[model samples]
Target: MDTSTMIFIAVGLIAVIAGLYIYFYNKDKKTLPEAPAAPGSQELAHSKQLRLQAYERLVILAERIALPNLISRSNEPGLDKRSMQQLLTQTIRQEFDYNLSQQIYVSNEAWEAIRNLKEQNIHIINQIASILPEDISGVELNKKVIEFIMNQPQGSMHTMVQEALSYEARKLMA
Candidate 1:
Protein backbone atom coordinates (compact mmCIF):
# COMPACT_ATOMS: atom_id res chain seq x y z
CA MET A 1 0.00 0.00 0.00
CA ASP A 2 1.01 3.59 -0.59
CA THR A 3 2.15 5.76 2.34
CA SER A 4 -1.08 7.81 2.02
CA THR A 5 -3.26 4.64 2.29
CA MET A 6 -1.36 3.49 5.40
CA ILE A 7 -1.81 6.90 7.05
CA PHE A 8 -5.59 6.81 6.37
CA ILE A 9 -5.86 3.30 7.91
CA ALA A 10 -4.00 4.43 11.06
CA VAL A 11 -6.31 7.50 11.46
CA GLY A 12 -9.46 5.32 11.14
CA LEU A 13 -8.15 2.92 13.79
CA ILE A 14 -7.57 5.76 16.26
CA ALA A 15 -11.09 7.17 15.65
CA VAL A 16 -12.69 3.72 16.28
CA ILE A 17 -10.69 3.21 19.51
CA ALA A 18 -11.70 6.67 20.85
CA GLY A 19 -15.41 6.03 20.20
CA LEU A 20 -15.28 2.65 21.98
CA TYR A 21 -13.51 4.18 25.00
CA ILE A 22 -16.27 6.85 25.42
CA TYR A 23 -19.06 4.31 25.00
CA PHE A 24 -17.70 2.08 27.78
CA TYR A 25 -16.94 5.05 30.06
CA ASN A 26 -20.58 6.20 30.01
CA LYS A 27 -22.29 2.84 29.84
CA ASP A 28 -22.48 2.30 33.61
CA LYS A 29 -22.57 5.92 34.79
CA LYS A 30 -24.97 6.82 37.69
CA THR A 31 -27.78 8.86 36.18
CA LEU A 32 -29.36 10.61 39.17
CA PRO A 33 -28.57 13.06 41.94
CA GLU A 34 -29.15 12.07 45.61
CA ALA A 35 -32.34 13.79 46.85
CA PRO A 36 -35.48 13.07 48.84
CA ALA A 37 -37.60 15.10 46.41
CA ALA A 38 -37.39 17.15 43.23
CA PRO A 39 -34.67 19.82 43.26
CA GLY A 40 -37.07 22.80 43.22
CA SER A 41 -39.80 21.55 45.60
CA GLN A 42 -38.51 23.57 48.49
CA GLU A 43 -37.92 26.59 46.34
CA LEU A 44 -41.46 26.45 44.96
CA ALA A 45 -42.92 26.28 48.45
CA HIS A 46 -40.96 29.30 49.54
CA SER A 47 -42.11 31.23 46.49
CA LYS A 48 -45.72 30.28 47.19
CA GLN A 49 -45.49 31.59 50.73
CA LEU A 50 -44.05 34.84 49.51
CA ARG A 51 -46.88 35.18 47.00
CA LEU A 52 -49.47 34.66 49.74
CA GLN A 53 -47.86 37.37 51.83
CA ALA A 54 -47.92 39.66 48.85
CA TYR A 55 -51.64 39.11 48.40
CA GLU A 56 -52.30 40.07 52.00
CA ARG A 57 -50.25 43.23 51.58
CA LEU A 58 -52.13 44.10 48.43
CA VAL A 59 -55.46 43.91 50.28
CA ILE A 60 -54.18 46.10 53.07
CA LEU A 61 -52.81 48.63 50.62
CA ALA A 62 -56.09 48.86 48.73
CA GLU A 63 -58.08 49.46 51.88
CA ARG A 64 -55.72 52.18 53.02
CA ILE A 65 -55.62 54.06 49.71
CA ALA A 66 -59.24 53.90 48.70
CA LEU A 67 -60.23 57.36 47.39
CA PRO A 68 -63.78 57.25 48.67
CA ASN A 69 -62.64 58.31 52.08
CA LEU A 70 -61.22 61.50 50.65
CA ILE A 71 -64.41 62.13 48.76
CA SER A 72 -66.47 61.59 51.88
CA ARG A 73 -64.38 64.07 53.81
CA SER A 74 -64.72 66.66 51.05
CA ASN A 75 -68.49 66.60 51.35
CA GLU A 76 -68.44 68.73 54.46
CA PRO A 77 -69.15 72.51 54.15
CA GLY A 78 -67.62 75.86 55.30
CA LEU A 79 -63.95 75.49 54.34
CA ASP A 80 -62.12 77.89 51.94
CA LYS A 81 -61.08 76.80 48.42
CA ARG A 82 -57.32 77.24 48.81
CA SER A 83 -57.35 75.36 52.07
CA MET A 84 -59.38 72.57 50.60
CA GLN A 85 -57.02 72.18 47.66
CA GLN A 86 -54.08 72.13 49.99
CA LEU A 87 -55.77 69.56 52.18
CA LEU A 88 -56.55 67.33 49.23
CA THR A 89 -53.04 67.52 47.85
CA GLN A 90 -51.51 66.99 51.24
CA THR A 91 -53.60 63.92 51.82
CA ILE A 92 -52.53 62.39 48.53
CA ARG A 93 -48.87 63.10 49.19
CA GLN A 94 -49.02 61.85 52.75
CA GLU A 95 -50.60 58.57 51.78
CA PHE A 96 -48.09 58.08 48.97
CA ASP A 97 -45.10 58.90 51.11
CA TYR A 98 -46.40 56.56 53.75
CA ASN A 99 -45.94 53.68 51.31
CA LEU A 100 -42.84 54.87 49.48
CA SER A 101 -40.60 52.40 51.23
CA GLN A 102 -42.79 49.60 49.94
CA GLN A 103 -41.29 50.21 46.53
CA ILE A 104 -38.29 48.21 47.59
CA TYR A 105 -40.37 45.06 47.86
CA VAL A 106 -42.29 45.47 44.61
CA SER A 107 -41.14 45.12 41.02
CA ASN A 108 -39.44 48.24 39.67
CA GLU A 109 -42.01 48.78 36.94
CA ALA A 110 -44.95 48.49 39.34
CA TRP A 111 -43.35 50.75 41.90
CA GLU A 112 -42.55 53.45 39.36
CA ALA A 113 -46.02 53.26 37.89
CA ILE A 114 -47.56 53.78 41.33
CA ARG A 115 -45.18 56.62 42.07
CA ASN A 116 -46.37 58.32 38.91
CA LEU A 117 -49.99 57.81 39.93
CA LYS A 118 -49.35 59.53 43.24
CA GLU A 119 -47.79 62.43 41.39
CA GLN A 120 -50.68 62.59 39.02
CA ASN A 121 -53.13 62.83 41.91
CA ILE A 122 -51.13 65.73 43.28
CA HIS A 123 -51.17 67.39 39.90
CA ILE A 124 -54.90 66.97 39.64
CA ILE A 125 -55.37 68.69 42.95
CA ASN A 126 -53.31 71.63 41.70
CA GLN A 127 -55.27 71.69 38.49
CA ILE A 128 -58.49 71.92 40.46
CA ALA A 129 -57.01 74.83 42.36
CA SER A 130 -56.17 76.71 39.18
CA ILE A 131 -59.65 76.26 37.77
CA LEU A 132 -61.54 77.40 40.81
CA PRO A 133 -62.81 81.03 41.06
CA GLU A 134 -61.11 83.13 43.72
CA ASP A 135 -64.37 83.60 45.63
CA ILE A 136 -65.14 79.88 45.63
CA SER A 137 -65.35 78.40 49.13
CA GLY A 138 -63.60 75.24 50.27
CA VAL A 139 -66.80 73.26 49.85
CA GLU A 140 -67.17 74.44 46.26
CA LEU A 141 -63.56 73.73 45.32
CA ASN A 142 -63.91 70.33 46.89
CA LYS A 143 -66.89 69.76 44.67
CA LYS A 144 -64.86 70.64 41.60
CA VAL A 145 -62.02 68.39 42.63
CA ILE A 146 -64.42 65.52 43.04
CA GLU A 147 -65.87 66.21 39.62
CA PHE A 148 -62.42 66.41 38.09
CA ILE A 149 -61.34 63.15 39.66
CA MET A 150 -64.46 61.53 38.38
CA ASN A 151 -63.76 62.93 34.92
CA GLN A 152 -60.22 61.55 34.87
CA PRO A 153 -59.02 59.19 32.16
CA GLN A 154 -61.75 56.51 32.07
CA GLY A 155 -63.16 57.80 35.36
CA SER A 156 -60.88 55.22 36.88
CA MET A 157 -60.22 55.79 40.52
CA HIS A 158 -60.08 52.04 40.82
CA THR A 159 -57.38 51.59 38.16
CA MET A 160 -54.94 53.81 40.00
CA VAL A 161 -55.84 52.30 43.33
CA GLN A 162 -55.38 48.84 41.90
CA GLU A 163 -52.11 49.84 40.31
CA ALA A 164 -50.76 51.07 43.61
CA LEU A 165 -51.89 47.85 45.26
CA SER A 166 -50.19 45.84 42.55
CA TYR A 167 -46.99 47.74 43.22
CA GLU A 168 -47.18 46.79 46.84
CA ALA A 169 -47.78 43.19 45.82
CA ARG A 170 -44.68 43.16 43.64
CA LYS A 171 -42.63 44.50 46.50
CA LEU A 172 -43.85 41.90 48.93
CA MET A 173 -43.11 39.15 46.43
CA ALA A 174 -39.63 40.43 45.87
Candidate 2:
Protein backbone atom coordinates (compact mmCIF):
# COMPACT_ATOMS: atom_id res chain seq x y z
CA MET A 1 0.00 0.00 0.00
CA ASP A 2 0.99 3.66 -0.39
CA THR A 3 2.47 5.58 2.55
CA SER A 4 -0.70 7.72 3.11
CA THR A 5 -2.95 4.64 3.18
CA MET A 6 -0.59 2.81 5.52
CA ILE A 7 -0.47 5.83 7.88
CA PHE A 8 -4.27 6.07 7.87
CA ILE A 9 -4.64 2.37 8.79
CA ALA A 10 -2.05 2.70 11.59
CA VAL A 11 -3.79 5.74 13.06
CA GLY A 12 -7.18 3.96 12.97
CA LEU A 13 -5.79 0.92 14.74
CA ILE A 14 -4.14 3.10 17.46
CA ALA A 15 -7.38 5.04 17.95
CA VAL A 16 -9.40 1.82 18.32
CA ILE A 17 -6.95 0.39 20.84
CA ALA A 18 -6.85 3.61 22.88
CA GLY A 19 -10.62 3.93 22.85
CA LEU A 20 -11.08 0.36 24.02
CA TYR A 21 -8.58 0.86 26.88
CA ILE A 22 -10.34 4.04 28.01
CA TYR A 23 -13.74 2.32 27.86
CA PHE A 24 -12.63 -0.51 30.12
CA TYR A 25 -10.80 1.85 32.51
CA ASN A 26 -13.85 4.06 32.85
CA LYS A 27 -16.06 1.01 33.30
CA ASP A 28 -14.03 -0.16 36.28
CA LYS A 29 -14.04 3.33 37.76
CA LYS A 30 -17.81 3.42 37.55
CA THR A 31 -18.18 0.51 40.00
CA LEU A 32 -18.64 0.95 43.76
CA PRO A 33 -17.15 4.06 45.24
CA GLU A 34 -14.04 3.95 47.43
CA ALA A 35 -15.87 5.59 50.37
CA PRO A 36 -18.64 2.97 50.28
CA ALA A 37 -16.12 0.16 50.35
CA ALA A 38 -14.58 1.58 53.52
CA PRO A 39 -17.84 1.30 55.43
CA GLY A 40 -18.41 -2.18 54.01
CA SER A 41 -14.95 -3.27 55.09
CA GLN A 42 -15.54 -1.92 58.58
CA GLU A 43 -18.80 -3.80 58.79
CA LEU A 44 -17.10 -7.01 57.68
CA ALA A 45 -14.40 -6.54 60.30
CA HIS A 46 -16.99 -5.99 63.00
CA SER A 47 -18.86 -9.10 61.93
CA LYS A 48 -15.71 -11.21 62.06
CA GLN A 49 -14.89 -9.87 65.50
CA LEU A 50 -18.36 -10.74 66.74
CA ARG A 51 -18.00 -14.27 65.40
CA LEU A 52 -14.66 -14.70 67.14
CA GLN A 53 -16.13 -13.56 70.42
CA ALA A 54 -18.94 -16.06 70.05
CA TYR A 55 -16.48 -18.88 69.52
CA GLU A 56 -14.54 -17.81 72.58
CA ARG A 57 -17.70 -17.77 74.68
CA LEU A 58 -18.72 -21.20 73.50
CA VAL A 59 -15.30 -22.57 74.37
CA ILE A 60 -15.68 -21.20 77.86
CA LEU A 61 -19.15 -22.71 78.09
CA ALA A 62 -17.78 -26.10 77.15
CA GLU A 63 -15.11 -25.86 79.80
CA ARG A 64 -17.60 -24.75 82.41
CA ILE A 65 -19.98 -27.63 81.68
CA ALA A 66 -17.34 -30.32 81.46
CA LEU A 67 -18.34 -33.11 83.86
CA PRO A 68 -15.30 -33.00 86.11
CA ASN A 69 -15.21 -29.23 86.27
CA LEU A 70 -18.95 -28.95 86.86
CA ILE A 71 -18.90 -31.51 89.66
CA SER A 72 -16.09 -29.74 91.48
CA ARG A 73 -17.58 -26.30 91.01
CA SER A 74 -21.02 -27.37 92.13
CA ASN A 75 -19.89 -29.71 94.89
CA GLU A 76 -21.37 -29.12 98.33
CA PRO A 77 -20.19 -30.43 101.68
CA GLY A 78 -23.43 -31.99 103.00
CA LEU A 79 -25.94 -32.41 100.23
CA ASP A 80 -27.25 -35.85 99.24
CA LYS A 81 -26.65 -37.56 95.89
CA ARG A 82 -30.01 -36.42 94.49
CA SER A 83 -29.37 -32.82 95.45
CA MET A 84 -25.89 -32.89 93.97
CA GLN A 85 -27.26 -34.31 90.79
CA GLN A 86 -29.82 -31.55 90.61
CA LEU A 87 -27.20 -28.88 91.21
CA LEU A 88 -24.88 -30.33 88.57
CA THR A 89 -27.61 -30.55 85.97
CA GLN A 90 -28.95 -27.12 86.84
CA THR A 91 -25.55 -25.50 86.55
CA ILE A 92 -24.96 -27.05 83.17
CA ARG A 93 -28.34 -25.91 81.92
CA GLN A 94 -27.68 -22.40 83.15
CA GLU A 95 -24.31 -22.23 81.49
CA PHE A 96 -25.75 -23.53 78.28
CA ASP A 97 -28.65 -21.13 78.46
CA TYR A 98 -26.47 -18.12 79.14
CA ASN A 99 -24.51 -18.75 75.99
CA LEU A 100 -27.42 -19.68 73.79
CA SER A 101 -27.40 -16.28 72.10
CA GLN A 102 -23.95 -16.98 70.76
CA GLN A 103 -25.30 -19.59 68.40
CA ILE A 104 -26.28 -17.00 65.82
CA TYR A 105 -22.68 -15.92 65.33
CA VAL A 106 -21.16 -19.40 65.18
CA SER A 107 -21.58 -22.15 62.62
CA ASN A 108 -24.48 -24.54 63.12
CA GLU A 109 -22.06 -27.43 63.56
CA ALA A 110 -20.18 -25.67 66.34
CA TRP A 111 -23.38 -24.73 68.10
CA GLU A 112 -24.67 -28.28 67.76
CA ALA A 113 -21.46 -29.59 69.28
CA ILE A 114 -21.88 -27.30 72.26
CA ARG A 115 -25.50 -28.34 72.67
CA ASN A 116 -24.59 -32.01 72.43
CA LEU A 117 -21.89 -31.62 75.04
CA LYS A 118 -24.33 -29.95 77.40
CA GLU A 119 -26.94 -32.66 76.93
CA GLN A 120 -24.37 -35.43 77.30
CA ASN A 121 -22.95 -34.02 80.53
CA ILE A 122 -26.40 -33.64 82.03
CA HIS A 123 -27.41 -37.13 80.96
CA ILE A 124 -24.23 -38.65 82.30
CA ILE A 125 -24.72 -36.96 85.68
CA ASN A 126 -28.31 -38.23 85.93
CA GLN A 127 -27.33 -41.73 84.91
CA ILE A 128 -24.47 -41.94 87.38
CA ALA A 129 -26.51 -40.51 90.23
CA SER A 130 -29.35 -42.96 89.59
CA ILE A 131 -26.99 -45.88 89.97
CA LEU A 132 -25.85 -44.70 93.42
CA PRO A 133 -27.94 -45.13 96.59
CA GLU A 134 -30.33 -42.31 97.43
CA ASP A 135 -28.63 -41.55 100.75
CA ILE A 136 -25.09 -41.13 99.39
CA SER A 137 -23.47 -37.75 99.99
CA GLY A 138 -22.82 -35.14 97.35
CA VAL A 139 -19.12 -35.92 97.57
CA GLU A 140 -19.78 -39.46 96.43
CA LEU A 141 -21.81 -38.23 93.49
CA ASN A 142 -18.96 -35.94 92.53
CA LYS A 143 -16.53 -38.83 92.83
CA LYS A 144 -18.63 -41.06 90.62
CA VAL A 145 -18.87 -38.39 87.93
CA ILE A 146 -15.12 -37.91 88.01
CA GLU A 147 -14.57 -41.64 87.76
CA PHE A 148 -16.90 -41.84 84.80
CA ILE A 149 -15.01 -39.11 82.99
CA MET A 150 -11.67 -40.75 83.77
CA ASN A 151 -12.79 -44.09 82.44
CA GLN A 152 -13.88 -42.70 79.05
CA PRO A 153 -11.67 -44.28 76.42
CA GLN A 154 -12.04 -41.54 73.80
CA GLY A 155 -11.67 -38.56 76.12
CA SER A 156 -14.35 -36.07 77.11
CA MET A 157 -16.75 -34.42 74.65
CA HIS A 158 -15.85 -31.01 76.04
CA THR A 159 -12.33 -31.29 74.68
CA MET A 160 -13.60 -31.98 71.21
CA VAL A 161 -16.06 -29.10 71.40
CA GLN A 162 -13.35 -26.68 72.45
CA GLU A 163 -11.14 -27.85 69.65
CA ALA A 164 -13.94 -27.37 67.16
CA LEU A 165 -14.59 -23.85 68.35
CA SER A 166 -10.89 -23.03 68.23
CA TYR A 167 -10.59 -24.41 64.74
CA GLU A 168 -13.52 -22.31 63.55
CA ALA A 169 -12.12 -19.18 65.18
CA ARG A 170 -8.77 -19.75 63.52
CA LYS A 171 -10.48 -20.11 60.17
CA LEU A 172 -12.05 -16.70 60.68
CA MET A 173 -8.64 -15.21 61.40
CA ALA A 174 -7.23 -16.68 58.22
Candidate 3:
Protein backbone atom coordinates (compact mmCIF):
# COMPACT_ATOMS: atom_id res chain seq x y z
CA MET A 1 0.00 0.00 0.00
CA ASP A 2 1.18 3.54 -0.80
CA THR A 3 1.94 6.09 1.97
CA SER A 4 -1.33 8.06 1.43
CA THR A 5 -3.50 4.93 1.58
CA MET A 6 -1.71 3.71 4.74
CA ILE A 7 -2.16 7.11 6.40
CA PHE A 8 -5.90 7.14 5.50
CA ILE A 9 -6.34 3.65 6.97
CA ALA A 10 -4.52 4.66 10.18
CA VAL A 11 -6.73 7.75 10.52
CA GLY A 12 -9.88 5.64 10.05
CA LEU A 13 -8.67 3.17 12.70
CA ILE A 14 -8.03 6.03 15.19
CA ALA A 15 -11.54 7.42 14.59
CA VAL A 16 -13.06 4.01 15.21
CA ILE A 17 -11.16 3.64 18.49
CA ALA A 18 -12.31 7.06 19.62
CA GLY A 19 -15.95 6.25 18.81
CA LEU A 20 -15.79 2.99 20.77
CA TYR A 21 -14.31 4.74 23.80
CA ILE A 22 -17.04 7.38 23.77
CA TYR A 23 -19.78 4.73 23.49
CA PHE A 24 -18.41 2.58 26.37
CA TYR A 25 -17.88 5.59 28.65
CA ASN A 26 -21.62 6.43 28.44
CA LYS A 27 -22.61 2.75 28.73
CA ASP A 28 -20.64 2.39 32.00
CA LYS A 29 -22.37 5.40 33.47
CA LYS A 30 -25.80 3.85 32.70
CA THR A 31 -24.84 0.65 34.64
CA LEU A 32 -23.83 2.52 37.80
CA PRO A 33 -26.05 2.27 40.94
CA GLU A 34 -28.79 4.78 41.55
CA ALA A 35 -28.85 7.07 44.59
CA PRO A 36 -30.22 5.72 47.87
CA ALA A 37 -33.91 5.97 48.64
CA ALA A 38 -35.38 8.64 50.94
CA PRO A 39 -35.22 8.16 54.72
CA GLY A 40 -37.71 5.78 56.33
CA SER A 41 -40.63 6.71 58.59
CA GLN A 42 -38.64 5.95 61.72
CA GLU A 43 -35.90 8.33 60.68
CA LEU A 44 -38.44 11.04 59.98
CA ALA A 45 -40.08 10.48 63.38
CA HIS A 46 -36.71 10.76 65.10
CA SER A 47 -36.00 14.03 63.33
CA LYS A 48 -39.39 15.37 64.38
CA GLN A 49 -38.71 14.36 67.96
CA LEU A 50 -35.40 16.23 67.96
CA ARG A 51 -37.05 19.32 66.51
CA LEU A 52 -39.77 19.20 69.18
CA GLN A 53 -37.18 18.90 71.91
CA ALA A 54 -35.29 21.89 70.55
CA TYR A 55 -38.45 23.96 70.59
CA GLU A 56 -39.19 22.85 74.13
CA ARG A 57 -35.73 23.87 75.28
CA LEU A 58 -36.06 27.22 73.54
CA VAL A 59 -39.41 27.90 75.21
CA ILE A 60 -37.94 27.09 78.60
CA LEU A 61 -34.94 29.29 77.90
CA ALA A 62 -37.19 32.18 76.97
CA GLU A 63 -39.17 31.82 80.18
CA ARG A 64 -36.02 31.55 82.28
CA ILE A 65 -34.60 34.71 80.75
CA ALA A 66 -37.77 36.71 81.18
CA LEU A 67 -37.14 39.85 83.24
CA PRO A 68 -39.33 38.86 86.18
CA ASN A 69 -37.99 35.34 86.40
CA LEU A 70 -34.41 36.47 85.92
CA ILE A 71 -34.72 39.13 88.59
CA SER A 72 -36.32 36.65 90.94
CA ARG A 73 -33.56 34.15 90.33
CA SER A 74 -30.55 36.48 90.48
CA ASN A 75 -31.52 39.02 93.13
CA GLU A 76 -29.13 39.25 96.11
CA PRO A 77 -29.69 41.24 99.26
CA GLY A 78 -26.54 43.41 99.14
CA LEU A 79 -25.90 43.64 95.39
CA ASP A 80 -25.67 47.20 94.08
CA LYS A 81 -27.23 48.39 90.81
CA ARG A 82 -24.03 47.77 88.82
CA SER A 83 -23.65 44.31 90.31
CA MET A 84 -27.26 43.42 89.65
CA GLN A 85 -26.96 44.63 86.10
CA GLN A 86 -23.89 42.52 85.53
CA LEU A 87 -25.57 39.48 87.04
CA LEU A 88 -28.66 39.83 84.90
CA THR A 89 -26.69 40.46 81.74
CA GLN A 90 -24.36 37.54 82.39
CA THR A 91 -27.27 35.22 83.15
CA ILE A 92 -29.03 36.15 79.93
CA ARG A 93 -25.89 35.63 77.88
CA GLN A 94 -25.23 32.27 79.49
CA GLU A 95 -28.75 31.07 78.94
CA PHE A 96 -28.66 32.17 75.32
CA ASP A 97 -25.30 30.50 74.73
CA TYR A 98 -26.55 27.28 76.25
CA ASN A 99 -29.45 27.10 73.83
CA LEU A 100 -27.67 28.51 70.79
CA SER A 101 -27.29 25.13 69.13
CA GLN A 102 -31.01 24.54 69.26
CA GLN A 103 -31.43 27.10 66.54
CA ILE A 104 -30.39 24.59 63.89
CA TYR A 105 -33.51 22.47 64.38
CA VAL A 106 -35.97 25.38 64.65
CA SER A 107 -37.43 27.49 61.86
CA ASN A 108 -35.48 30.56 60.77
CA GLU A 109 -38.29 32.87 61.80
CA ALA A 110 -38.58 31.28 65.24
CA TRP A 111 -34.82 31.40 65.73
CA GLU A 112 -34.62 35.04 64.66
CA ALA A 113 -37.44 35.92 67.05
CA ILE A 114 -35.67 34.17 69.89
CA ARG A 115 -32.44 36.04 69.10
CA ASN A 116 -34.27 39.36 68.89
CA LEU A 117 -35.94 38.71 72.21
CA LYS A 118 -32.58 38.01 73.82
CA GLU A 119 -31.10 41.22 72.43
CA GLN A 120 -34.12 43.26 73.51
CA ASN A 121 -33.98 41.88 77.03
CA ILE A 122 -30.28 42.70 77.26
CA HIS A 123 -31.01 46.19 75.99
CA ILE A 124 -33.72 46.68 78.57
CA ILE A 125 -31.49 45.52 81.42
CA ASN A 126 -28.61 47.75 80.36
CA GLN A 127 -30.87 50.70 79.69
CA ILE A 128 -32.50 50.50 83.10
CA ALA A 129 -29.18 49.99 84.86
CA SER A 130 -27.68 53.01 83.12
CA ILE A 131 -30.58 55.21 84.23
CA LEU A 132 -30.35 54.12 87.87
CA PRO A 133 -27.83 55.44 90.38
CA GLU A 134 -24.67 53.36 90.69
CA ASP A 135 -25.21 52.77 94.40
CA ILE A 136 -28.88 51.80 94.13
CA SER A 137 -29.73 48.44 95.71
CA GLY A 138 -30.48 45.31 93.71
CA VAL A 139 -34.05 45.38 94.96
CA GLU A 140 -34.52 48.84 93.49
CA LEU A 141 -32.92 47.75 90.21
CA ASN A 142 -35.19 44.74 90.05
CA LYS A 143 -38.21 46.94 90.64
CA LYS A 144 -37.20 49.28 87.86
CA VAL A 145 -36.55 46.42 85.43
CA ILE A 146 -39.91 44.91 86.15
CA GLU A 147 -41.58 48.27 85.73
CA PHE A 148 -39.91 48.86 82.37
CA ILE A 149 -41.00 45.43 81.10
CA MET A 150 -44.51 45.98 82.36
CA ASN A 151 -44.75 49.29 80.55
CA GLN A 152 -43.78 47.84 77.16
CA PRO A 153 -46.79 48.16 74.79
CA GLN A 154 -46.32 44.77 73.15
CA GLY A 155 -45.43 42.93 76.32
CA SER A 156 -42.05 41.43 77.21
CA MET A 157 -39.56 39.73 74.87
CA HIS A 158 -39.79 36.46 76.73
CA THR A 159 -43.55 36.25 76.28
CA MET A 160 -43.27 36.95 72.59
CA VAL A 161 -40.46 34.42 72.07
CA GLN A 162 -42.34 31.81 74.05
CA GLU A 163 -45.44 32.40 71.92
CA ALA A 164 -43.43 32.16 68.72
CA LEU A 165 -41.80 28.94 69.88
CA SER A 166 -45.17 27.47 70.80
CA TYR A 167 -46.60 28.39 67.41
CA GLU A 168 -43.70 26.73 65.61
CA ALA A 169 -43.98 23.61 67.74
CA ARG A 170 -47.70 23.36 67.06
CA LYS A 171 -47.17 23.65 63.35
CA LEU A 172 -44.63 20.86 63.47
CA MET A 173 -47.02 18.63 65.40
CA ALA A 174 -49.80 19.19 62.94
Q: Which one is best on lDDT?
A: 2
Q: Comparing 1 and 2 by lDDT, which wins?
A: 2
lDDT of 3 by residue, 60-171 (tens): 9989988899999998989888888889999999999999999899877677767866776787677667766777898898997786556554445566567667866886
- Kindly report which residue pairs in candidate 1 clash with one another: 80-138, 81-138, 105-171, 106-170, 106-171
What is the lDDT of every predicted structure here? 0.55, 0.75, 0.74
Error of 2 at 20 (Å): 56
Q: Runs in model 3 with CA error above 4 Å?
A: 1-40
- For candidate 2, give the lDDT of residue 65: 94
Worst 10 residues of 2 by lDDT: 28-37
Per-residue accuracy of model 2 over 1-174 as CA lDDT, tens digit each = 234643443454345334434543554465433323355587888988999999999999999998888877887899988888889999999999899899999978678778877876776677667667888899998987787667555566687668767877886786
lDDT of 2 at 58: 94
- CA lDDT of 82 in candidate 1? 79
Stronger candidate by lDDT (2 vs 3): 2
63-87 per-residue lDDT for model 1 (tens digits): 4444455657555577777777777
